[model samples]
Target: MTNDDSKVGDIPGKRSLRPLGGVLAAMAVSLTGTRISVVALPWFVLVTTGSATQTGLVAFCEMAPYVVVKAFTGPLVDRIGPRAVSWTTDLASATAAAAVPLLHALDLLSLPLLLVLVALIGAARGPGDLAKEVIVPEAAERGRVPLERAMGLSGVIERLASTIGLAIGGSLVALLGPLTALAVNAGCFALGSVIIKLALPRSMGHTAEEASSPARKTEPGYWRQFGEGFTFLRGEPLLLTVIVMVGITNLLDAAITSVLVPVWARQSGNGATAIGLMGSVMGAAGVGGSLIAAVVAQRLRRRLVVLTGFLLAGAPRFLILSFDAPLGVVLAVFAVSGFGAGFVNPVLGAVFVERIPRPMLGRVNALGDSLSWAGIPLGGLIAGAAVTAVGLAPVLLACGIAYFLTTNLAGLRREWQEMERTGGQSVPEPSSKDDASRGNANLAT
Candidate 1:
């Protein structure tokens, strides 16, 4: 192996792993809170109003703000520093979430007010989440963690968080009611903000580009920074292709999670508890897959890992659901599907980290994530309507086939091939002057 390869292998020890530990802890706390709110908020809306449409509309309000704000805030994150953005916005989310239950108790809550509060929470969450994503590569580089390993670790954290959070959320809602769950969520977010603000080291505050840039003393205008991210993505076909693939899959996945699952549960004669259990099973499977990736991804080719994952993940759940399988069988199918999905994010994360320069990381990551997630609300809407019109089994089968074809066939494109071809070599760290110039360019339009 080359010296660079050796360096890659040795990365976990070069910088403090403490920062990664701190960041992941914060992420777990924040995500757990969010998951709890997901269950609690919808339950609150549905039980009180007795309207499924209203529940759907409330969800739409929350996600719309998330997609819109994240699309525009990438550059700001790059310019201002992710650390500041993460902590402050988390504070905002905590406040918004806390208000929902507190106002309800005070008899001051209205539907419109609740919708607006959830929207505010979504907006704050978008930037806060993006900031954390942008910081991952830098944190890895600083700690000498291999990019793939770091991203894999991130995926593991997310899966583990979701599993534990959803399980807890279900129990909380069942025992204490949704409002109490919301209150718990608020506390978690507040605590997460505190941990991130106080525990992380000063050196972890800035990107590598910022540390090396001499011109960093002068703050550029916002539009320029935004344009830079757009221009870079526009010029990179490989990046564009991956973004498109991710977006399509995200839309399909959203449909499965939000719409198809509930319909399937009802049709199969299982109640809401069974539906919740399906999620728990999938999440548990995902945690295992993510752990495997973190430990062994270096030995796998990125393209093959992604393609195989798509093949398994996209096909089985839909096929099983189409048969109106028993609840136990459905859970098993979804568990495998979750395993496949787990392989996806870490590889994709590593790819983005490797290709993008450090300075543009925040904007580009944010833009891509927002774009990919933008279709989630639409997915839920379309899936619900389609299931109602066409019946559950047919829609499930059709969507499953479409998802499988889209994800697997997209890999055949030439651009995807180019993106997957890594040379297994790491470039040397840039000198200070070069780093400064690169940083400036990365932030420029």
Candidate 2:
């Protein structure tokens, strides 16, 4: 069926609820598994080696693969279909996660081996994550959900996952050892993969061209398709600007979370649980922000929401850390910061879904996501060195100020204004005549 036809099935008031429920359920399971590993893995490294640098290195290794692999595989996801890509990669991640704990149990775990396993998981997960994102527009279409609401629901899902997952991760680590927690994580990934594969409607997987080109096939060559995606993104200025802005913010965020926060916790004498709790608090507050976005995001100016979110999210937590506030106060500050951040993704997601053509969704989404996340490893590295040199508090304060300035200042650019315009309108549904022409052209291939 056509996308317009897909939108017709939902009753106005209740339409977004069902598909959003499915998406949120899938995200909760998957992110819970990831969050558990986030806790368990670092704890394992720190306990085993007693080296902060080593722990940072492990994070770097994982993110390096994630960025590189995702950047290159966007076209593959577009060509092969997100459903198959998502399920297969999730299975691979589950296997990698399970291997870590099993090897540890056998007394065969080594640092290099652990890094390799995590890197593989990251690589697999990159495309898998992209696949899920690519499917959002389709899911929203099928559910007759407004694009903003669908995106807002995604933000809520992430926030809920972070809050619940961190809480559960900490508890699991305390009760069952890091290895056992990891095993549980593996199980969650497996279950999540199954749910996405089975629970989603078959029609939910259809691409923009699927209805018209049942027997037509694209060229089998991988590099050509990959090149096409890159080429398309290069020509799209508004999209490029969004990617760059997100990338800068991501870098700053990575530094804050991975490097500065740990140092701050150690200085404050609260230890790792405090770090986890800080994250949980932020996540909890983000839930409220995400709900607000879900309810009213479509009515507000999209760019203003994003800019405001940046202003609120970036500086406050850093200032809190710089002051060495008590645990409770720090948690509160994080909550405020997270609440601001919660609105960001939904706005950006809706913008992307509205502007990008469905035929190129996989590659473009993958490319944008990979580029935005590329700075994560570098941020960790820089934060580690900066803390080692300048001490943690001063660096954190500087980062907070810089983040506030950078984001707000960037909003003044003409490119950002163009992005706002591009995102404000709905994508027009293509005519059947256009679809038929594209199909005939495809059949000749």
Candidate 3:
């Protein structure tokens, strides 16, 4: 068998972890930075504006462009090469992120200015995040790791970032101030850009069309490429089902994190520290769960795991917070929830990578992710408005019920049965000639 197919323990020589390690490191810093901002930004807005609606508006501004730009950037990422796209966009995000604090310090930061800066950050970050995801299979191959395990490891990195970043961000926001956390966020973006540019092998993450069959010498236009992804995704019932379900849950999650939790903390007198502590508890437990998934997920039934995970991961946190629960009870519920949440992404990511052809990975993944995150921009906005009108308790109860219903009802769909199939592997070759020939019109290499 070829070395590429070798299992981790059975490799002929040393397995190189550099490629995977670099990617993980880059993911770690960037996600951690983002998480820190999650804590810092909302708090900053709430304290300054004293308006939950405005806080939600800021989140809407950031994520709206994130979803829109990401939906359309699939073609650019595929053609320009993910590696180049990753570093350059990260650099742009860094600059935009840095500008937030600089403008504030100069006493010139207005609401409009903040929104513009964050919108720019979101725009650059859309493709930056997509590029990082596009390279995961290549990183796994170079590391001689199983794709599922690699995805699990990626989840672990994400959770770890959430843990560390939240903890630090809370402390920074509490003691030094939000501006400090914002500065750190900018630094993390810069560091991630550097890692992607300098750490990985120069040959890595090149344009897929360049490495594909000679028929790819001719490439389709941008809109044509975008349509290909939309068409392929439209035909896949399982993927579409997954996307719809995930989109609902993502909206709920965004609401919970961006507005509900923050409002709860303030109302309960728990403040920013509690926000960090709760998130840290959950994230730390998630790290443990992701580690186990990395080891054993390949042997499990993915649909079952996913359903069970959602069962644990959803509803309870919202329900618990609906009442005047003590801090201990809240933390315990969040820990269990986080643990369940950890197993989800690895399996989902594996399912996505396995089913889609390599040549179509960029556009397909971008479309899939964008769809799954479609409701996020409105999540905080709705939550903020709901909390303002009806109060936190009723909104929490309602969201919890909605979360419960969405995940459970989704399991009834027959498309979920396809989750068990071993469809395609993340090999360099195309899954089928039809898939490979889709963009063979005028691709520039």
- Candidate 3 structure quality by residue, lDDT tens digits, 37-121: 9889999899889997788789779988998999899988877678888899999999999998898899999999899999999
**Which 10 residues in a row give candidate 1 its minimum summed lDDT?**
4-13
Per-model CA lDDT versus the true structure: 0.80, 0.77, 0.84
lDDT of 2 by residue, 1-445 (tens): 5543345323322344444455567777888889888888899889889998899789778878988998888878767677678778888999999999899889998999999999999998888888888877767665656677778888888778877777788789889888888898898878778877765544444434563564435454677667667777787777787888789888999898877888888888999889878887788889999989888887888789989998889988889889877888888888888899889888889877665666667877888898888787788789888888988888988998888888887787777775554434442332432354345434422
- Which candidate, 2 or 3, has the higher lDDT? 3
| Clashing residue pairs found in predicted model 2 | none
TM-scores, in order shown?
0.91, 0.87, 0.86
Number of clashes in every candidate structure? 1, 0, 7
lDDT of 2 at 149: 76
Number of the top lDDT candidate: 3
Q: How many backbone clashes does candidate 1 have?
A: 1
Clashes of 3: 7
**Which residue pairs in candidate 1 collide?**
11-144
The ten-residue window of minimal lDDT in model 2 covers 4-13
Give the residue spans of candidate 2 off by over 4 A: 1-20, 51-53, 203-216, 269-273, 324-329, 420-445
The best-first sequence of candidates by lDDT reads 3, 1, 2
Number of the top-ranking candidate, with TM-score as the measure: 1
lDDT of 1: 0.80
